[model samples]
Target: MQESHLSAAPQRTGNVIVAVALLVLMAVGGYFRFVGQNWDDFTSLHPDERFLMQVASGIGGPTTLSYTDPAGLTQEQADQRALCYERYPATSGIGGYFDAACSPWNPQNVGFGTFVYGTLPTFSTRAVAEVIAGLSSDQSWLTFYPIHLAARLVSGISELLIILVVFSIGLRLHGKWVGLLAAALYTLTVFSIQQAHFGTSDPMANLFAALSILFAVCVQRDGKLRDYFFFGLAFGCALASRINLLPLVGLIFVASAVRLLPVFARGVAGYEREAHWTQSAVGIILAGVATLVAFRLLNPYAFNGPGIFGLTPNSAWLDEVGKARYFISGEWDAPPNWQWIARPRYLFPLWNMVAYGMGVALGITAVLSTIVALWRLVRGKPGALVNAVPLAWIVAYFGYMGLQWVMTMRYYLPLYPALVVMAAWGLA
Candidate 1:
């Protein structure tokens, strides 16, 4: 008993050391993410950030509780109260809660017609700004400078969460040392740090993207109902942050398929197969339901106004999304589209990722580790297939985005966590 106790002491000490190291790494990462949040001062030099702030600033609680007839109001008053009747005190009861148009949270009702991105990031930043304004009784927090800072702070917090998620993923895949290494590496990543300093949706979207991957891995490992449910929630949050992350939903199907393999093998061998199919099917269905519910809640304006179901389509929002896609495809003859005219598809993104975004060493290490992981899986190596969840996502996302006309660096933000994990795996 004494020998066993002495042997366990080192292990406990090691765990404490790891815990302390992780905390220190997180502190350093938080400092990098939060610093220089006000880099552009009050000028709002970044066009995307400026537009997002404009939409956020426009979103607020209704000033009046009484419903006013549209016919009695002037054009200005009508515009000011565009969907006022759809929201709270103006349209009270439990019905108002379900009626998205009347909720006062939808950006569409605020009169902005061209909101293309997901609503979660803008809503999150605005919520912070509103709290500050309410507490201080000073509307300055709702102004350009302070609001943008709030957005930046939110973005920073999201990235900080991402670092933690990356660590967890690495720990699951390898062990604590690999997790620590990946977290430290991601903490120092140039692009992540740069994005964290901006008041944009990219970091928030990236956070959800990382989370989806994490939960997908969890489902791959345990094949539990709750894991699938959480994966769906993360996927929905990712979709609500950026529609571009719609591809991440594929991870759910992949995990489900992997979970079914053992059952299929057992059946083929004439063994008594357990009733796992029903469980997996239920999990998948539950995941889908969770995804839709989360998306609807976070992005309420996607539907037409005033109902418990709120299932009717909003044609204006659909049209704006279509236009945004067209512009991104370089078919709109816009100024931003010109940059993609002669740019080679995959090479441009690859070059930027290696040279500027990830730095050459880490990028090369990730590529090599991914190749090694694939090779091991091909050889039927034990535990090698665990990498498939993230590897598949990386391939699918890069394959689709690399072919796109707009090869912006931030478009590849979702790939960072997986890449860092792979890099850490290689080094370990």
Candidate 2:
């Protein structure tokens, strides 16, 4: 025992050192992305950020309205603001391209798609911008960066946390070296790097998904009630961050159920010893309840449901639903002769994302994750079933993403954490 303890100490210390180093590296990467680029990045920011900025700015006419004074605008400044009201974020010359449509001001019909990612984050940043916007001393800081930068920083921090989660999950499954390897690859992944400096729900959802999977692992290993409850909360937050998490969360519950099934086989005898499966079962129930509460907490509009959901065809959520329907059908809006079955489109997008985004080495980990997970199930090795938690996420999520008709780098961000974890497992 003494020899084993002595041997483990250096490894533990190494894990700690690796964790700290990776944290600094990921943070610096995120920070530099925001601060590094000297050129006109404001115009290059995502349309979603631009839209949320206006909603928070009291200019875009958000349905979930909160009124603010053009807080710091001089008469001329206010007049210039009026000129750009309901217009694109930045002019075309800089980098801004789209002439985004303006939303009608209605507090009641804010829609599921709008607030699902949370009204609070954008509102908070906007409030900060209003204060700075009102400042008479400096005009340069008055632009969208004050508010936009906050959102980006929040996302950047979330990405950093995701890197840590990937490292931790990998370490749990394998050894410190592999964990470090997986995390190093994740930090440089294309999708992660692209969204690391942008402010939006994608990173938030990605972080929460990582948290959910982490907590699920805890529940599997220890069968602790809090782990189950925390897992539920994390999954719920993922949902609130974006509806895209729905399928992922569903798989988690299914995996949890499968993990707990042996308890049923064990009958009352399984309740003996140090492990308690019954309480863990209760904890899973609490996870469901917690999910509902958290969803409503983050986006109260979700509580209204159905007819009141998006309110109109032009509402943001209604528009999203239409897209989803089109997505499921896998059709493009091209002429009939130009169109085909189209499901194949989502596959290449998934493949290209994994191939280029993760780079050749780590991307193979993602591509092979499904095969390894299935092989583990077939082999029935020690901890093979325990691996199901992450496997559920890996298999279901990639399948879900691969079938969708539309794709983008941001859309692929959620897969990075799981990819790294599974890659670590595969390598081990």
Candidate 3:
């Protein structure tokens, strides 16, 4: 039977190859669609790249504490810091928002700053900045062009890492061919290419999401403590990068705790392992908290006390500045004439809309395939439901969609690799 499975591998490989080719073609198409709008402009505004430049300039570096005045920052500093915090908040280790002297574009409207743009009193931006700050020590290297270049190099490598991780997950769960297909599909997917190139937190966030899935599977396969540690680390990184992932981390904790419960019921062996589990859990929580504190100490809000999470109004400081930039003049808000209702209609034309609306169709296929695969695994189907990682992915997607109405294409990008793999399995 094993030999037969091996024999069938080549056919699977061909399907994956075709799928990957199609995905790559799509990415090339997307690149042409959006990249032409202003490749350099978009790249410059890339949030992560912007932060990297700030880090290079000592905006949020190791010595952030020394430069900041306990007496409260100057109006110039406050204004700049406010802008920085709106984009990149302060954290424990990383200094207060830097790179005030630089920043060609403000994300107030045309940028991805709306949902998360607040003063430095929050965790999400600061948490991410701390991790980035910790990544480098030499404050001088954080300049825009230099850091942008460095970010590209690092992000490119990270993209490859994502590919490898995806492949490994596919291989372990499905087969060599499935792994190849997923990797190939990922490589060709325009959405992956676009996000991977952008230095925003999304790519790293995607990496962390994938890591959670990877570790979850590993735990299912072997129930190893090391795997759980990896899971914790991945979850930590995810939260550190984007707090939108906190729910996913919560799922991991619950899932892992459940996995360990039966063993704990058996006693010593389970209890002995408890310390290791505790450490792993602590590591995740601390990575998040420590990042927050490190930023807070450096850029303590003038009017507020120490807290990693809270909200403070910027209107006071802005009012004092005599600067309307923070007000209607320079503010970035949804355009008054902007029609949110027609967004989906504008995105997909009539015929394409019908086809693209096929998320429902694709979703139905995924559900049926997942059920059949699961049944096969239980009743000894040759391929099994092991290839249905995308089902969990779909669950995450619907959870996001139902919880929030604002669904962007990027939000669904990570799931494509898994979905393609599942589709292949269903076809097989």
Number of the top-ranking candidate, with lDDT as the measure? 1
After best superposition, candidate 3 residue 401: deviation in angstroms? 3.8
Candidate lDDT (C-alpha), each: 0.82, 0.61, 0.48
Sorted on lDDT, best first, the list reads 1, 2, 3
- lDDT tens digits, residue span 1-428, model 2: 99999999998898689878787767765664455332335674566776665444443333322222335445643443354453434431111111112222221222223333454355445545555656745433335555566566667677777777887777666667767777776777766766756767677788888988888777766667787788888877887677777776664465557556666654557345225455655777888887766765544343322222322223444454465556545465655324334436666666676677777777876678757777978798766786677777777787777666555557767777887777776776
Best by TM-score: 1
Alpha carbon RMSD to native, model 2: 9.4
Report the number of backbone clashes for model 1. 2
In model 2, where do residues sit more than 4 Å from their true spots? Answer: 1-5, 31-39, 59-146, 261-277, 305-346
**Residue 362's lDDT in candidate 2:** 78
**lDDT tens string, model 3, 248-304?**
544444445544544555455755677657754664465445434533333233113
Across 1-428, the per-residue lDDT of candidate 1 in tens digits comes to: 99999999998998898899889988999999887778876889988999898878766554433222445655644644564433444344112433544444556555455778999999899899988889999888887667998899999999999889999999877888899899989988999999998888999999999999988888877889998899889988998899889999888888777767777763354333445777778888988998988988887667765664767876756876897788688777878788788888888898898888989998888888888987997898988787888888888999989878888899999999998999999899
**Alpha carbon deviation, residue 22, candidate 3 (Å):** 18
Q: Find the number of clashing residue pairs for candidate 3.
A: 15
Better of 1 and 2 by lDDT: 1
